[model samples]
Target chain A: MQKIVPNISVDCVIFGFDFKQLNVLLVERKLQDEKTGETLIDDWTLTGYHIFEDEDFDTAAARILKGLSGLDNIYLEQFYAFGKVSRVDSPKDNIWLKHQHEGFSSRIVTVGYYSLIDNSTVTLQLQERNVKWFSITDLPELGFDHQEILNKALEKLRSKLRSEPIGFELLPEKFTLSQLQKLYEAILGTTYDRRNFRKKVLQMKYIIPLNEKQKAVKHKPAQLFIFSRDVYERTKRERFDFSI
Target chain B: MQKIVPNISVDCVIFGFDFKQLNVLLVERKLQDEKTGETLIDDWTLTGYHIFEDEDFDTAAARILKGLSGLDNIYLEQFYAFGKVSRVDSPKDNIWLKHQHEGFSSRIVTVGYYSLIDNSTVTLQLQERNVKWFSITDLPELGFDHQEILNKALEKLRSKLRSEPIGFELLPEKFTLSQLQKLYEAILGTTYDRRNFRKKVLQMKYIIPLNEKQKAVKHKPAQLFIFSRDVYERTKRERFDFSI
Candidate 1:
């Protein structure tokens, strides 16, 4: 066994963004009833683990995401540390833990991380088996303080999306303007006026319009565009308003 | 004793922004060399605590600020979590912990928080003796991974300062344009063209110019202005570019 630190864990909220909808990767956990002695299954949780002594938190969190989603290369950004003294084990939690493991001792402090990944590329099967992508709208009951973690992740995602170019991380990259607008609408929950949206996108020099067109569409083909990271690198400004 | 989870703590990087210089609140920690048995003193550290089971992360961090800085009502924003597996009791760290307590167990994950407070209004005397404010430019040798923590706090503070109207937190309510420019220069480590800086400041509608002038100065008095939060709330844009 790796020299994992006791009572300290890293939890990841993996946000998957497709043009149509936003979803998060949550693992389904199996537990047993202490009083009834019956196995209960399918309790959802954010993928997590206690880091080993030699491991950095970022590496540990990335490992957890890779193991749960069966994909690599997605960079994880830590958003918060959920360290309420009772986060891991309370009397009520202990009763729940009795079904999860042999025993419960001290509480665990969880550091939360979040990353945006392209949902279209992820596999349907997870290595640990029951983990699945739940759309942000139809989320199920989650174990521990996972629901709180998920909410925090959403808050950060929305805030980060507004001020940054992370939109490309969730998209197919060479995508149409309509698809870009749809992704923004789905995440922000607000519809932008088509004319105004197009105007704003056109003015943003970093979003380069390509010569290619949507080939498979039945309607008039829409022009495609890609984000220019090089231009953004050269032009990033100090806006002087960091609310999010 | 209150139910506190072992091996988790909250460290505050209390930034005091006086118009002239950027300062941080650090507590003096005393230690004894395990090999020499000689008392070592004046090892500066950030003010922090292991959270009680009853307290939330926000509450715990706020309590730390109140206890050490004796200032309340100042908003504290958590920026990052530092959780390397051996953060608490590494062999190099164990030598120092020998003087702190009988022994250190497990590992402590410290959640880092930062806040901008007006240094002029703050009372110097603290509940914990030897707590002192040191200019960020002239920092002393800090205990533990506090130097790392302080660096992270500085990074966050600079980012936050660039995008928000938090400059007021570091300046007197009524301040001259020169003072404002100097505050930005000190934090950002860059010089601004006085004409361009004044032009930009004049264009920002939220920076309300008062009929006041600087007093008790040997030099010619300059015009004073204050940041208007109300105007900012109403007029702040969704500055679509989120690059630092």
Candidate 2:
């Protein structure tokens, strides 16, 4: 058995961007009263686990993500540490925590990490039915402080999207400009003028346009573009603002 | 009695800037053997303590900062959490850890916070002789993983400096343009062309030039300036890059 720290845990907010909306990967948690064997609470939450005694927080986050999604080398970033004393204040959550851990401590400090996954690129070998993706706009009641953690993760992702090329991590290899705009809109929670958005994005040398176009589509085929990591790495400093 | 979590700690990298150089606040730690009462290790380390069970991490960090520096309302930011299994791998550090806490866990996790202080604005009621300021360029070997913590803190500070107006927290209310340029140079560890530096800073509408000059000085009196929070808040979205 892994020597896990009961008081400290690592929670990951895994974000996957569909062509239309931003969705978060969450696990369904069902709790039962140990004494009465009565169902107490059933809710969804960000997938997380207590960290191992000998592992770094980063390693623990990666391990948890891999174990749950069977995806590796995802873009993971540690955003915040949520250590509110009343993090597990919900009576059901408190009871559930105590029932799950052998020596559950009253105060648990959870480190929040946000990860971006290109779902189309890799098949997620999810072995469990309880784990599923929910649109950010429509989320169920989450267990513990996972809701707050998810919110903070989204906020961090938005800010990073504005400054860094992390948005590409959630995108497929070949995509239309409309898909790119929709991705930005989904994450930022704002709609941009189509003409202005294209003009701004086109100015960025890193976003390389390809001659290839969509094949099997009812509507008019649009040109495809791929984000060039080499170009971005070379000229990332020259004001690549995506705040619009 | 206050109950503190022995396994978790909050270490602060308190940074102060004189007109000449950037300085960090560190506390000298002295350790001795329990059996023989022999001096083992004596070195400087970031000032921090285990967090109280009932308080949030932010509250604990603020309380620790106030307790140590006698200064309130300082700019404090949580940068990262340092959790390595071998954080106390040094034999002397291991012994010291066991001596300090009654039930010291083998593995400890520490959340790192960085604080900015204007040394000239308020008198630090440092009740102990162990704490002192050291220049970033000239520093003694720190204890445990404090050196690594400080390095990460500095990296965070530099990136924040490029984007935010946090550098103002370290300087007096009224400062000269030369002092401002030197402050940037000290933190960035690179000298900038004076004319270009002044030109870039002047373009920003926030760094307002006051109709004032130095009163008592050995050299020529330079014009004074003050950072306008109101102006910054109003025009912050218009590219407030301080990369120079």
Candidate 1, residues A1-244, lDDT tens digits: the string is: 6766766788999888767788888877766666897775447888888777678788898888888777788867898888666775644456567655733345677888997788888875545558778889899988888998999988877777777788788877788889888888888877898999888888878899999999988999999999988998898775554432
Docking class of 2: acceptable
Number of the top TM-score candidate: 2
RMSD value for candidate 2: 3.8
DockQ of 2: 0.30
Report the lDDT tens digits of candidate 2 across residue range B1-244: 8987888889989899878999998888887667898888889988888888898888889988988888888899998888787886798788677677667567778999999988776556577547888999999989998999999999878866766788889988988889888988889888888998788888878889999999899999999999888888877663322111
Model 1 CA lDDT for position A229: 89
TM-score of each model, in listed order:
0.82, 0.87
Per-residue error for A225 in candidate 1, Å, reads 4.7
Best by lDDT: 2
How much lDDT does candidate 2 score? 0.83
